[model samples]
Target: MSDRDPQPVERQLPTEEARDLLALVRDIAQREIAPKAAEEEDAGRFPREIFTLLSEAGLLGLPYDSEYGGGDQPYEVYLQVLEELAAARLTVGLGVSVHTLASYALATYGTKQQQVEHLPAMLGGGLLGAYCLSEPSSGSDAASLRTKAVRDAEGSWVIDGTKAWITHGGIADFYTVMARTGEDGPRGITAFLVPGDAPGLSGAAPEKKMGMKGSPTAQVHFDGVRVPDDRRIGEEGQGFSIALAALDSGRLGIAACAIGLAQAALDEAVRYATQRRQFGRAIADFQGLRFMLADMATQIEAGRALYLAAARLRDAGRPFAKQAAMAKLHCTDAAMKVTTDAVQILGGYGYTADFPAERYMREAKVLQIVEGTNQIQRMVIARHLAGPEGR
Candidate 1:
């Protein structure tokens, strides 16, 4: 509400416990993750060992209830951990975000039996998860998704269709799939938990993506894949709502990734400016370049504030869909701008893989596209403001 401090701020300064957690994560990130990121990404490799390290450190399940073997940490804490991970490597950050999104359906909608059966593996770190909501024909328009699941005489659900652009597609141990079960609308959709080894369930070869190369992306094909009715999440008509609700939280995760990427870019820029001298002085000493760094830092701080505010709202059980969408849109845009500027600050070296900024720039592009494009985020926010029946 004051000039120096903004209203609706999201993050609390790192608490003692949070600071300890951050230190632990940072140590692992810089020492363990940073060295391998570039090589793994270049080879399109997924780091199974790194995930094991994170799980052993109690990081894989940071935000869920503790009874399920999670850290039971706050989003505020969880997101900062994510930021550090991403600063080290975007692929890991994105994979964690996707896993968290996949967890939402089971945590929020599944029965107690289901939770007990699934959460331990997910929280304990043996199994990875994939979220299957988007299809070849439907990305932003989720309600128009074509995948279908029909009930059989044996009281099982038979699913047949392809899910496109699935993160962890071929690599995941399980998938959270949404399929149409009723009339042609979101209300007709239902969610199911499908194990990776299920018969007739398979994935296409991974997509050759522009960035986040270490993170596998592919199309999942469910050809008459069957599951018991108990596998369905929530009631028959609740999948769309569940997916959107999960996305409200997922958007914040992406926002954290953006902040981490931007911070990495800024750090590289600052380091480069100091080391790469111009006119017989460190370039950072130049007021023009200094101002640009100031702007980049300011934007990143603002993005952090926005996403954290929305996260606090969600944790407090308040209406946060609009705020989450706004955070996703603004923070991702700011990250894209900041990372690009980071490259510019590094001048020629920024364009090469020798430094991390070039990769950060490429990684930022996907943040804009995934978890609902910034364009779709704008529409979500606009709809929230304009009311259910818009003018």
Candidate 2:
């Protein structure tokens, strides 16, 4: 049997680059975000000010090229920044992740002119973005999306559909939308850049969610909204591929968020264990509880390793869909398990809104559901193993 590389939590090579960014992100999150995360979540307020702080800190474009106002940072560095933010506030981390997803099409597939027109604002100008690929009838099975786009005589197109579960919904400055432009199938879809103020485009009231309440989530409706053909991200019938490619990269972001959330939960549990007294001793001294802590820490390390591996594959221009699926699956599941266990360690305190554990537990559930569900991730990995002939 071939030997496989062993994974470790803290890097042995000592990546100064990743460390520096992580330190900065941690500072910002602690100073500006951590204090308010709980309040915003409780009040159902959007942290747009925090978003501006991130953009101004040159963090909004961490994984993109510097030519377009981006940081030109590596995925390794970018992901850790996301992790730090998630540890502070899941809402902000998830909002950043979703914005990165919405911006992928322009960065990866748009014409040079298109990128020049939009990339700067998206990267460093505090402009939020939303990705619109899912419809009421076509969430998991996106190829069956019914949104239609028809080209007009004036070289414009009229798009009509309702996109569901759009993060940043009414708050975003622009949307990267996928609509059917041909016959029914994945190949029939096309991608477009629609401004938030475009005619006939509107968002519904934000969805009542289980957690991550500070980040807005709602349905966006396009009723005869028009855009110039020049706004298209790629050739007609290429939206499905673009959307899938975005997800391949976007999954890494979700994985990072999940790992961060898990790390926070683990930290809280460990701190609580050490402080809370038992029978004349700290609960952490108990062997059974210590083993639980060990398991939580181990799972967190595994989640981080999985996402970093996927990120390396992505940066190297390798086929990363399988790895991305694996990262998302493992990390989100780990987040759920770790957060739930944290609540158990916290005992009755974890169940109350006064603490963050219960909130983090609820937030972790959505991570498993989004970026393609954990079930979808399994299907993606299985397809890789089966190969084309297996189809």
Candidate 3:
């Protein structure tokens, strides 16, 4: 099984350029990312150099405008790239997704001057970014965050709070931070582009996690970290809106990554089944195992379709938040189920670190909880369906 390559996905790309882009991505994934994934992940080592390679290749900012160092690809193409990267390694794929999320507020809401000043360096200049919204006390209830950003006499904002579950945390070059600047609820929140090395900014130790340890998840502290007015991405009290918009796009990235991870697991399971002999026959000859593989593949395909549909809606500049939530929920759930089945198919070998199946299973679990928990996704979908819940 180790000697054979996994089959490439048959993608329906809109343009020849996109096909070329996918080919480039596949080559890089096969040559650079996939080979080192399991070992680096097992060692809990972040592949900062691979991200530099991606930045150089213009993969980091594919969905944003090309004028300011972005690739200008639509979400459809951008997400497929993410899926390919994720199939190679969740750490790299999810890192790219979080970086994109961190860049969204500035690209979408910042002034032309801001974009001209920072976007180029962020997008393709070997810089990494982190998104800061989830707080230690408020994960699901992000609107109820206690982080405070106060305007001082110097006209600079002094931020004071701790943001939890930040993907890049201490390692990021910049942070897109959402802090309370006014009232007690969502209305008071404001977004700021804070430099990672700003005075009083620090990160606690990375969380020891069930999976994806190679991607640092840490608590970022803002102890009176100050930023100039120019660093504010959008209007005060408009931060939550920016956050929601970014999350809608970010959820699609997660959905794509989930499908990619599922696809990888399915490929591994198939490869093992075809090679491993049992009862004087290959395991692939067993109907039960074949059915499991079929089910896993179907779910992955469905998830890919769902995420791409959401991406297309986004590319058309249409309303897609509900669809985004749905894709995230379904794809992540599919990832968990598919990874678990892959582990089951591998039998005892899947339970140990000797195989990638266990790692895939561990990684799939966190997807259901991030971006927004699956519970929050259901609520978001329900709100779109039944209107806002009676409070």
Candidate 4:
């Protein structure tokens, strides 16, 4: 709403094409996304049309293989693009991340025949996806999921159970689901690619969330939902491993998003303090407020560097699970602090919805709890440092 242009991000891209990709992302974000973000968020309206535009622009699957219609960009470049989108609007950025996560199983584990048959439609054909992992009783303990998929005599699978906190639950064109196929425990789980319109599958009403209402989060039910054997991804009893692998990369996506949210809050605070005067002088002239702004900006930069480092490790085919957890923990915590400080910076106006500070504050809270909680991230780091649990 300010007449000024969106703040520019200084980036170090390896190639000229990557720089151009970032530029196009910023242009679409400012012109198409940021302009409608505040209004649509307030109205709790999901912008399906904007997603269609992103698909056409080849922005939906940047990190996947271009042989299957993906952009074939590295995780390092793809994550920066996520940060730009998150800066403009959390819902759009996070939604894109979830879609990419949902596509992971098929893209990575599917056979050549399966990839050729499905990847094109999923990555570039304007189809949205949802990931179904967490169940009603399973939160941080995801491997203990109770959803069962039984193989029938005709080589068809029948799924029965509930999947909770699914993003894009009702609107997605496909769902990458994890279900129990054998005995209890992580090794017993299996992955499946289920069409959205599968028989006996339905979504409950979206949760009345405190923020990010524009991105629907709901419970999905499968009552004898049937699919052919060919729809399964990876081997039997391999779902839990696939889920964790996806989250390793997905955590970096979340870390980038958190940094982006913090950057937006910092930009707002800096803009407000420099323009608004107190006692015939700008509030930015005060030492206390100036130091506060400095600290906020520093946190954003540090978090950005942390996530990017993790992303680079992933790109290099190195072991980065611990680093990914560290990035997720540090970045989300920083976002919570920075956005809260931005609200404090504005004092009265920040509490009301008149400015974006309050919305950013609300949106940042969920980042701490999503992908994996900060507590879970800490556990992951400690396990890597010491040894596996009970070792």
Return the top candidate by lDDT.
3
RMSD of 1: 4.7
Better TM-score candidate (1, 4): 4
Candidate 4: tens digits of C-alpha lDDT, residues 1-391: 3344436779979999999999999999989999999899999999999899999999999999999989999999999999999999999999999999999999999999999999998999999999999988999999999999999999999999999999999889999999999989999999999999998999999999889979999999999999898999999999999999999999999999999999999999988888788999988899999999999999999999999999999999999999999999999999999999999999898999999999999999999998889999999999999987887
RMSD of 2: 5.1
Estimate the lDDT of model 4.
0.94
Per-residue C-alpha lDDT of model 2 across residues 1-391, encoded as one tens digit per residue: 0132222136422377667777778789989999988998999999899889999988888888789988888787788788888989999998899988999999989999999999999999889899999888888998999989999999899999899999998778999999999988999999999999998999999999999888889999999999999899999999999999999989999999999999988888877888888899988899999999999999999889888888888778788899999999999999999999999998999999878899999999999999799999999998898865445
Residues 202-283, candidate 3, lDDT per residue (tens digit)? 9999999999989999999999898999999899999999999999999999999999999999999988988889999999
Report the lDDT of model 3 for residue 120. Answer: 99
Candidate 3 has what TM-score?
A: 0.99
The runs of at least 3 residues in candidate 3 whose Cα sits more than 4 Å from the true structure, single-residue gaps closed, are: none
Q: What are the clashing pairs of model 4?
A: none
Query: How displaced is residue 361 in candidate 2, in Å?
Result: 0.5
> Across residues 121-154, which tens digit of lDDT does each residue of candidate 1 receive?
8877667889999999999999999999999999
Sum up the clashes in candidate 4.
0
Query: Which residue ranges in model 2 land beyond 4 Å of their true spot?
Result: 1-17, 388-390
Q: Any runs in candidate 1 off by more than 4 Å, and if so which?
A: 1-15, 388-390
Error of 2 at 318 (Å): 1.6
Candidates' C-alpha lDDT:
0.87, 0.89, 0.96, 0.94
**C-alpha positional error of residue 257 in candidate 3 after TM-score superposition, expressed in Å:** 0.4
